[model samples]
Target: MPTSSSSPPTDSPTTGGHRFHALRVVIPALIILVWLAGAGIGGPYFGKVSEVSSNDSTAFLPTSAEATTVQNRLPDFLGEDAIPAIVLITSQQKLDSADLADIRTLAQDLAGLPEVAGAVSPPIPSEDGLAVQIFVPLDADSEVDAAVEALRAELAATLPGGLTSYVTGPAGFAGDLVEAFGGIDGLLLLVAVIAVFLILVVVYRSPLLPIIVLVTSTFALCVALLTVWWLAKAGIVLLSGQTQGILFILVIGAATDYALLYVSRYRETLRDHDTRWAATKAAWRGSIAAITASGGTVIAGLLCLLLSDLQSNRSLGPIASIGIVFAMASALTLLPSLLMAFGRSAFWPRRPQPIGDDVDPQVAHLPARGVWARLPRYVARHARPIWIVVTLALLAGTLGLTQLEAKGVPQSDLVLGSSEARDGQAALGQHFPGGSGSPAYVIADEGELQDVTDALLGTEGVASVAVTAADSPSGTAPVTADGVQPIGPPGTPAPDPTVDDGDVLLQATLAYPADSAAAEDVIRQLRSDLGDRAAIGGPTATDLDSNNASIRDRTLIIPIVLLVILVILMLLLRAVVAPVLLIGTVVLSFAATLGISALVFDHVFDLPGADPAVPLFGFVFLVALGIDYNIFLMTRVREEALHHGAREGMNRGLAITGGVITSAGLVLAATFAALAVIPIMFLLQLAFIVAFGVLIDTLLVRSVLVPALGHELGRHLWWPSRRIAAASDPAPAAVRADTADR
Candidate 1:
């Protein structure tokens, strides 16, 4: 074990060394300036993402989905595109004709709003005579949240005193989603940044070092955003509010994790090399493989989402992969340069003391102490038991997966906090048909309009049917067995249905809420009965397809992701057995996370359910990131094993890398935990699963399970290594006895 010496080494610089010193300083300065310029260019893109991004679910559905097809062809048959808002007004007393006139006047007023597109329908009284419902269509391209706000404000001021008003429909839900995601750009970023900063501050205990690491992370995020923003603007890819929020957190967490590894290497390397440039180069050499491999593993896992049938999942593949690329690049390039430029002063009050100059920087390294040192000793003593206990514990947690209900949550539950739309949904269901305003749309051949109408009317949950009529006073005509009914007096002729190419649109009013399971069942039944005759779409169908697509994606992509990561690990460590064990461990960890999350979500938080995509996203992040920690550990272990032998190397690697990796995991967990601040159920659940899994991987799995398992396997862990047999030896007796020694 190498102990620190008080005497410092003399600086005997050669003429050439002195000459190149200026060049070395100049190179780092240049790198810093270039990164600064990029950061400056990308900083403002944070606010501009909303310009090219959307919260519209339909726009991000798989192109092959029936809902997507219906959405695309809707403007053709309807003559315009719009989001529908349902206005429900209820009074304690039965309404008279005067009340009906006032409701009609209010509908007219709503039609005059700039955000309202086409026409507002006349109020239809419920059978109870105490409530009325009206449809107000809004321009889909405009700021819908603002439009909804304005409409609510209008209702507050204009509606008669006896009536209570609510806006509830697809448009209302969209507005709620927008409001929930409104915090992504500013508040979410602020919370994540603050959480990361606090963790870094605690981990480094040096004000300046944490700042440098944070700057590297922030710059990476800025550049990633700058690139992704332009890509989205060019329409090369799609962006959503959820994706945008995830990008912010992913870039920051990944970049910071990479930076932490580099910082650890740089701090340790500084002990041997007196020159800042030499220390920077040596540290880069020490950490680059692990950093790059870890980043690549995550990128590969994220890219597996490209196989997803859901467009949202597919888009996340490229978007998050871009984030990871920048994370690696910035850590490798910017962080080293920053550390080199700052020199030892970056550590501030507790600067690392350099070893004597004559020592070889490659072989000379610092010893490990504290719990990190002691824990490795424990693993070395009881290797088999340690791994067995941890594995059983993890497997036990996996048993909770049976409680996971990942079928898909109700639309009303998507936003986590208070919601007017959710309340309005309840109100609407209490009076008129539960699926008011958001009707299932059927697009079929104009020739089959009658047949489609009859089939829809015959459907179990369907309450009524209507066909779009270009000449109708209200833009739609009721359809009965006789035919399309006149919109006006009995003597008037029926309005002709709108025809686009050879297709016509039929709207089916459902007896159940559009987002209800019963409604989804209705859509499924309709699709079955009307096979090839008509395409069924709308809120219920969209949810059904999105959920089904998510299920398919997870089933297909999870296994592929595991294989991709396994191959990456094999290449990274040049070992097949270790990679397999690591993958199995991480997969076990993910299952445990899901199991525990299920318990917490249902028993603790009382969440209704989860989007089917939750498990898939959770698997992608936990497995990729769980493997990331192991990569850092094993890469260091392999490096040490080359000289010290496998048993000794595993112990030394765990002691040295454990603290930094734990710090990195904590930073990542904190950043993800910040997502809970945003009032969306998906982000909240994702935050918990990933954050908790990271901590589990960090403090337990990577710390004890992997090291103990590696200790048990010894040289066999590094299969195919040329010096396989020699790799099993333990550290010299003197070092092993010291307990605190490296």
Candidate 2:
């Protein structure tokens, strides 16, 4: 029989009970104060994340990647590491002499800006004569967003009455990305906090309890940010807007989820014990295993990203693992202290009353009349049918997985709301070579430069090609089948191509938009033809390489994460069958989540497509998080199984853990769903997949499927473990009748 233990009697001075009592109050108070100080110090670091974070795609490529090599050599060939911004000037009619002169004056004015590199190109007239384009290079080392804004301001103020100008190209697109991520620190955090507070308030139905849980979550986030910020500053990890947003959400959701579990145990302990300290100790003891195991499982899964070839993926592993560590610490240490301080008053109007010692442990600890209590009885009666039907339903949902198209989304479609760069790219494509401004760069030996140029020109999407020449006025001498062309009047001598370490740079302008599928296909063809002889990179090639790296990371990391999590579950459960069963159900839940998300993304939302990393991220979060609810239930079930028989213990475990795990799941889901407000396509997709998947796992898999299957299997579910006695006899008729009525 499981017995409730009381605190040491404080009146006995000889027994040292007085000393133990003093330490309880003193230790909890000190823990609370330390967390408060940490939160105060760490809170301000959230706004400073931009100082250490980067969104530059090229920075994330593998060192061995061709794109990374080409990107490194760009400065030597182009004179400066500058991102080009194309200014498109258009008029309703053909430009008159005055309009042409005004455009030239505007271009010259743009060249005077401090952020402008080298020289601004002279206005080049379009074939229709209705528009003129100027290429402006902005120093990549400067504040790109500010420079782009200044250029836009100058163009807006100086453009002639009939001409309209737009800043587009690499720098322009990078500026747009910077602006899109600007709200991550402020808006994302605010929305997540408010969403979590509201959900916690409804779940606890108490004012003070929700605030305590929120404080635990927020303090964990602040501390995590403080740690990650310094790590990024020290150049140990790469920080990006995407990674920062995920870190914030992961910390808050995970902390609150763990807190909810502890709170549930603490509240239950309060009902059985008279003293707050005794209840605190009991709750902490009961909840620590599940909380730590659940947290460790998530951390292990995240750390698996360390094996990823992409730096961005690798960076998230340690960054998020750090967040999980703080989340677990806050839940086990800070939250318990806060709860101990408040005691039963944290429940306010609905505070639980202490039960007499003679009361039944099962009746006092587990709800006997709620929905959770009734659910176990229903599963007990229709165990096999329930598992079979739910399994079939989940399997049917997997059919939609075939509709998933996670190849990758175009860079232009990355930001969900209206994007100036996307609009500019469209306009730029209409008037110039579709890949104007952003060209595919090729670096090869000087002797093979002409051969590489010939290969580029022969490629179907190549509209034009040029060789970087130090002596040329525009820095590039146009390349033709005949070789480099002169820049001056007819018969002028062609400039010699620039050479560094016997390698030369060749720029190929494509006939398709740089971010379009057509351009990616062209770059792929070029890569296939050039092989190791030439290195190719640009905005298009960067996208291609990133997509491929993400695909590779997914393939390599997914299985490793599954295996890591399986090992953790086995060690935690002390049984092979239960861990395997839990893993299988979580995987099934992930597949169903992806399938539903695919159908919703394709048919309902009408999205362009998903990023390749989306599935990998979705799997990592869903599987690790989905297994959390099962861990909570099964750990409790195993504890009860040690006292009662396996059949009775499974019923009691489901009845007691059902409400708390469901509440935790709802809290986690709401926090993740809050990510949708950010308007980033990847965040939005990941938000839905995880949010929906958690609810499914909580309500269906944990509540129905696992419990039902376990009930049917009885002690066999814990096979090979002598801890549970295998019951070969059938359950009593009276027990079945009593369960049916309840």
Candidate 3:
């Protein structure tokens, strides 16, 4: 083993390295100026928005005869286009005449609203009926959003007696989601600033340095967020609300980290010389490789999201990758200039040390020599058993994934408790033999055809069906020059007119509510039952399809990302054997994170298993961040190997880098812990899982197992690299020269 000889840099205090620091500040100021100018000018665009416009008359026409023409010929058509927005009925008992009058008034108000296309009341039994179903057809321009708001406002108004009304639907859900995210922007701004401020204060131990680091990091974060938004607006990327939250956390946390890693090292070098220029150079030289490697691995990991089929996950990958890239650039360029401007005063109250530089009291007693020097030997003896146990436990818990049911959570689950809408659903379900909310189909065909209606009435899931006169809203007669009109009008035995080229229309309603298990099952059966006779179209059908697609994408994408990371790590480490073990350990750490998250949500938090998307996101983030620790530890291991033989190098490397890596891991974990404070459960799960993954990665994978294996493998660890035998082969000037003769 080797020992210190290069003066430990900190043993001799000096004032130097200020020139490079000054340049760092000036360059960043200029860059900020450029960014501000670009922002003011509306940034850049690949193409104008006007390029995507359409001029076809049929595109916007609500009553396209061609659409109706095709609809009549289809085996099924669930007039999803004209489907009424769902409405809830609320009352404590069967609605009295007065209750009915208020409801009618409310319904009339909705009908008269500019956006409402039509309205209807579903026939509901009066026996023990506290609720009734009201259907409102959103006007052609209204869509889901307008209907939810209009109905919500109407419900909020004081009603007759003690009755209460609430609305829930696609529109209502959109409103709720918007409300949930109301103050998130402000909260994120406050949290990020505070977090960066606190971290800088602790690391630099100076008020001004913290402020500087905070400002630079915050600027970098702002640029990243604006970039994400620009990309989203330009259609180069897609980001949901959750993705926005992730972008906020990752940008600030990572940017701050880069600044800390560089600045802290810069401060350490300041103690060695009086010249700021030399100190800056030394810090840059010593820190650049570590920063590059750490940031590179993180960016690489995040980029793995590009392989994902999920648009959300895919978008996160590049956004995070871009953030880390900017952070690295700022650390190397912007941070140095800022440091030179501040000089030794950046340390604030802490006086210049004669023998030590910028040392934190928290790690003042951390081992620098002796029995602790043989940290790798300790790791070697215990690594296998500990690794094995943890691996088995994680693998065992992964079995739960097999049991993971992948389906989209209904909009109902988006709200808390049995909300007014849910109670309304319960009421509707009770009063109606079959839930009144069942999706209805409008089958259209050319020529009057009573036979189509007869066929639908005979179908298995079909309840009582109703159809209205097929008249064009524009007052174009339903009959064209060829005398065409749609199939039947309920009890009317009119001959079905040709929707277009030998087709007719028939309406069918299911015997179950849209959200019920029976409804979904009935839809499947209806599809099979109708065969090629109809085309299904409804929100329920669309929701089911989208849910399945999301599940399928998540199922396939996560494992592919892990496999890619394994291969990348293999090439980076230049060890086929080590990569496999490394991947296994990472997998264990990830599973442990999930298991703990499960425990928290299921037992501690006393909530149900997390929403479906939570697990997928947790998996991606844990794996990506977990690899950061491995890269940190492994890079140090490789550096030490080039200096001391494999055995001594492993121990010395662990001893030297362990504390810093642990500190970083804790800081990163705490950053994730901030997510737990968010109000949403999905974010809470993300926080716990990521925090747990980092802890396991730091303690189990990097600290104990990697060093243990390094010792166990010895020179074989660096196979094919003949330079492995060279005792100062790739010596890092500061640490290696000191430990060279150990």
Off by over 4 Å in 3: 1-25, 32-84, 112-129, 137-150, 192-206, 271-274, 285-310, 350-406, 416-420, 432-513, 516-518, 530-533, 606-612, 676-679, 726-742
Question: 1-742, model 3: which lDDT tens digit per residue?
Answer: 0012234323222444777556645665686566455434432321221122111111221222322333333333223243355566666766777777777676666667665654444323245757655666554343344456666776677456676665654444444544444334667557656765776567556778777676666566666666666676677866555666676677666666666666656665665555555677777887777677667767776776676544556667887787787667667766776776566767778734323444543233235565455555455555556556656766766654544433554555544433545555555555663535444444544333344455555666666555433343211113222333443355634433325344444445566665555666655665665555655544445444444544665687677777777777777777666667677778777766676566556656766444556767777777767776777667656766776666666666677567656666766676777775545556667778787788878776788766666655666767666655555433223333444444
Better of 1 and 3 by TM-score: 1
Give per-residue lDDT, candidate 2, residue 733: 52
Q: Any idea what lDDT model 1 has?
A: 0.88
Q: Write the per-residue lDDT of candidate 1 for residues 277-380, one digit (tens) a residue.
A: 66787899988889888999999999999999998999999999999999999999999988887788899887876765466654455244578757888788
lDDT of 2 at 130: 83
Clashes of each: 0, 0, 60
Error of 1 at 411 (Å): 1.0
Name every residue pair that clashes in candidate 1: none
Residue pairs clashing, model 2: none
Q: What lDDT does candidate 2 reach at residue 720?
A: 66
Error of 1 at 166 (Å): 1.4
How does each model score on lDDT?
0.88, 0.88, 0.58
TM-score of each: 0.96, 0.96, 0.76
Residues 1-742 of candidate 2: C-alpha lDDT, one tens digit per residue? 2223344312111234777878877998999989989899999998788889888889999887888989998998888778899999888899988999989998999999999987788888888888888999998888778889999999999998977788888888888888878878888888889988988889889999999999999999988899999999999999998899899999999999999999999888777666677778889999999999999999999999999999999999999999999999999999999988887788988986676557776678877687986888888888888999999999999999999999988888888888777887888777889998899999999999889999999999999999999888778899999989999999999999999999999999999988888999999999999888899999899989889999999999999999999999889888888899999999998999899999999999899889999999999999998988999999999998877767777888999999989998998898899888887899999999999999999999999999888987788788767787445224645446767665
